[model samples]
Target chain A: MKNSLLSIYNIAKKDLLIELRNKDVILSISGFGTIIIFIFSFAFDVGSSLSSSTAAGILWSSISFASITGINRSFMLESENDTLEALIMAPISRDIIYLGKVVGNFIFITISEMVILPIFAILFNFSILSLEFITCCLLANIGFSVVGTLFASLSIKVRAREVLLPMLFLPCIIPILFSSIEATSMIFQGKGWNDLSIWFQLTVAFNLIFLIFSLFISNVIYED
Target chain B: MSNIIKNKLLTCSAIFMFINLYLIFIWVPTEANQGAIQRILYIHVPVSQISMLAIILVAVSSVLFLWKRNQFWDKIAISAAEIGLLYGTIMLLSGILWAKPVWGVWWTGEAKLTTALILYLIYVSYIMFRNYFPTGSQGQRIAAIIAIIGALDTPLIYFAANLWSEAHPPIVLGPASENDSSFSSNDMRIVWLFSTITFMIFFVYLLRIRYKLQDTISKYLTNT
Candidate 1:
């Protein structure tokens, strides 16, 4: 287990090093997240009758949509550079590769969320810095990252991946989307732990199930 | 051997289906509240159950295919996903038509409805992924991963969607619904039980035929 953790850390570090060099995925995800917020404001007609729930909804929805680009780019870079096979052929068990990717994605999305939340706060006019809201974001980000990584790896070879990833990922992640949004909305509405616990537990369950399940199938996911 | 089994199953389901139609139309009393619109319940509910069952069937078959490295389970997974989409379309259409006069709209983001819609989209994405990914063992492996994740996500989807809406239909056709169903008349209950069983058999019949067709196509592709 120690060796495995080290290998996972190493793989994740590799991803982080590459990302730091270019910052393409992080920049695009944050930019897309901001654009999503703006578009939703138009749809909801900003400043007329917006509620805290609406603010919470905007925040989570942007995160979910923006993270898709990050996911696609993560794998796309490897496949596009012809490095997926080299990584898969490395001296490591397949699950480590899968876990590493999941860890990398989870961090990338969290960083994007940091950039997004403050911008969302200013536009949607919410305090948006409570401990409960931050807790909800972390849980939701983990859920999003795990499922996104699995499908991104699965669809890496598909020709229409740009269109197909969201089509595939959105449906699988709907529960996460719902759970996090509900949790965030309740936090915005001044609901306490009693109400937030249910959504948080659901989000945690979703994350763990996908995390274990995707690991079980990750060997198949990366195989030739 | 396969031909004989499929023929027998098809004949049995057809006879059972005719009897089911008779029972549903002539025997069961029309619900007073929704009137004729509620008759869609007979068609909608059974197909809805089958569509839900298909996700589990596909997921199990997918797991088996990945573990055993066999084409038989792959065939089952493919056929089940395609058949699930067929029933899903019927379920969605019937639900929408029924909802028009009853719910006063064609669609609502209600818990069950949202879950069903998302499940249908997930299956559709699976089919799309299978087609877009190159035809090979790797394709089947990735598809299995998709099925497993989708099945695991099912209950959470309902939970999250439930948080958004409370208006719902009563349970029918099971022990749990014995006292829960609003339409608990003996005739409705009896017909619903029979209809559900018949539709399940029909689902099996279609599954077998589709599996055979997929087998032949794969064999032919491999031969050429």
Candidate 2:
């Protein structure tokens, strides 16, 4: 267990270091996320009767779309350098690699969300900086990162991965998207934790199920 | 041997389909509220149920494929997903037809309807994954992973939609209560059961043919 944890940490650290050096994924994702928010504001006429729920929906939709780009980049980076092949040949288990990528993708997506949220708040004229809103974001991100990384790895070998990743990832993340939007909307409405607890629990449940499930099946994708 | 079995199953399904058509149109009484349009339920409900069952079958076969590393289970998983997608498409279309006259709309954000659409999309992506990565262990592995994750995430999808629909009460047109005895009548119950069984048998029949077709294609590919 200890060794596996170390391996996972090491792999995640390597990915983070590479990302820090390049900064391509984070920049592109955050840029795309900002563009989506801007477009949504214009398209939806955000200044009018934009409810908090609508704002929440727009915010999540941007994050979800941007995260798809980020997921593709992360896996593309690994596969580009044949880093995935080398890692597969290494002593580390496939689940360890999966956990590592999940951690890495989670951090990347979180960073992009940080950039997107402020822009979303400014454009949509809503304050989403509350603790409850952030908590919901974090929970939803965990579910997204876990499931996204698994699918990203799976789609890495496909020819039209850019198109395929979102197709595969979007439906699976509907629960997270719904829960996050609902919880955030409720938080904005001054609903207490008691009212929003169900959404939070649902997000956490999705995260747990995907996390454990990805761990168990991650090896199948890499194994010949 | 397989050809003989396939022919027998095809004959059985055709016979059952004819019986189902007769039972739906003539034997079953028209619903009081929905009138003749409600007869779509006989086909829609059974196909929808079978589609869900096919997804479960895909998940089980995926597990088996991953564990055994056998192409047979992989074929079964893909074949089941394809057949599931067909049934899901039928369910969605038949649902829209039923809803048009009944609900006065082709679509609604209702929980069950939305979940079924998402499930259909997920199945489509699963087939797309198979097509995109045609010949590798990578493709098979990724498809298996999708099947497993998609199955695990389905209930969460349903629950999230349920929660969402609760916040904004849907404009429901059909039954007012959950336990409305539309099917509680002896005749309705019998027809419902028979249709469900017939659909299940039909699902198996399609699955067998699809599996055989996939097997033949793979064999031909390898030989050439």
Candidate 3:
């Protein structure tokens, strides 16, 4: 178990190093995310106090779109280098490699989200850098990365990978997307912790299910 | 699996459907609140339930396909996915038909409708993925993973949709909604029971036919 953990960490570290060199993955995520926030920023009055829920919806939908594209690029890069096949050929278990990619994807998206959130707060006139907000966003990002990694790898070989990725990814992520949006909205509205607990539980539970299921499914999909 | 069984299923499904139609029309008294339109429930509810069952079948068959590495399970999963999409379309259409008169709108973004629509979209995309992916074992494995995720997503979607809908009130409840005790008469129960049975049989027959078509096509291609 410790060895497996080490392997996962190593794979994640390797992925991070590669991402750092070109920075393509992070740039694509932030670029796409910024464009979305830019559109919403211009569409709504710059200083208008948007409804907390509307702000939450805008934040999440943009994240959803950007993160999916980010995931597609993450794997696309790996495939271009043939590293995915090499990793699959390695002695380490497939799930370990999958978990590694998920971790790498999560960190990349989170870093970009940090940059994106402040801009959204300024444009939408709502602060969301609070502890509760970060917690909710992290939970949602975990979900996005977990499900996205699996679908990205699965779709890499498809004829229409670009078009098909979002279609496959969105439906599966709806629960996480809604839970995080609602949870963050509640926090923005100054709702009690008791109310936020349900959404928290939902995001955590769905993330766990998708995480475990993705690991299990990875073994089969990655097999020779 | 055999001609005799298929024929038996076909005959029994026809007879039961006829009996269910009779029960829906003549046997169950007209609901005073909604009048004759309430009869759509007999078709809608059963189809909805069976459509959900089709999703479960897809998931289970997908799991078996991945575990056993058998094409037969893949065939079952694909067949169920196609049929689930059909039944979901029927459910949605019937719902809109009833909602127009009862709720004063063709559809509402209510919990039930929203959940059904999302679940239907999940399967539709699942079918679309199977179509877009190439015909190969790797494609089958990926599709199976999609099926499993889609099935497991149903309950979470229902729960989240329920929570989200509370912020926006649904239209006035039309009587004979599954929740309405007034609709729970012995007559209603009888009609619902037979209708569900008829639908189940029809589903089974359709599944067999779909599976056979798949088997024949694959066999023909291999021979050619």
DockQ per model, Cα: 0.74, 0.80, 0.68
lDDT of 1 by residue, A1-224 (tens): 99999999998999999999999889889999999998988888777757766677777778888999889998989998988898899989899998899889989999998899888887777777788988888888888888888888888888899999999888888877777777777777788989888778888988888888778767677886
RMSD of each: 3.6, 2.1, 2.4
Off by over 4 Å in 2: A1-6, B174-181
Worst 10 residues of 1 chain A by lDDT: A48-57
Better of 1 and 3 by TM-score: 3
Residue B200 lDDT in candidate 1: 94
Which candidate tops lDDT? 3
In the range B1-224, model 1's lDDT, one tens digit per residue, is: 87788889999999999999898888788875556656677888999989888888899999888789889999999999999999999999998787666656677676888889988898899999999999888788888888877887788888878865642243233222233243657778778889899999999999988988999999999998
lDDT of 2 by residue, A84-154 (tens): 98989998889998988888889998988889988887887777777888889899889889888888888
Number of clashing residue pairs, candidate 2: 0
| Residue B87 local lDDT, model 2 | 93
lDDT score at residue A28, model 3, on the 0-100 scale: 90
User: Residue B53 of candidate 3: its Cα lDDT?
Assistant: 89
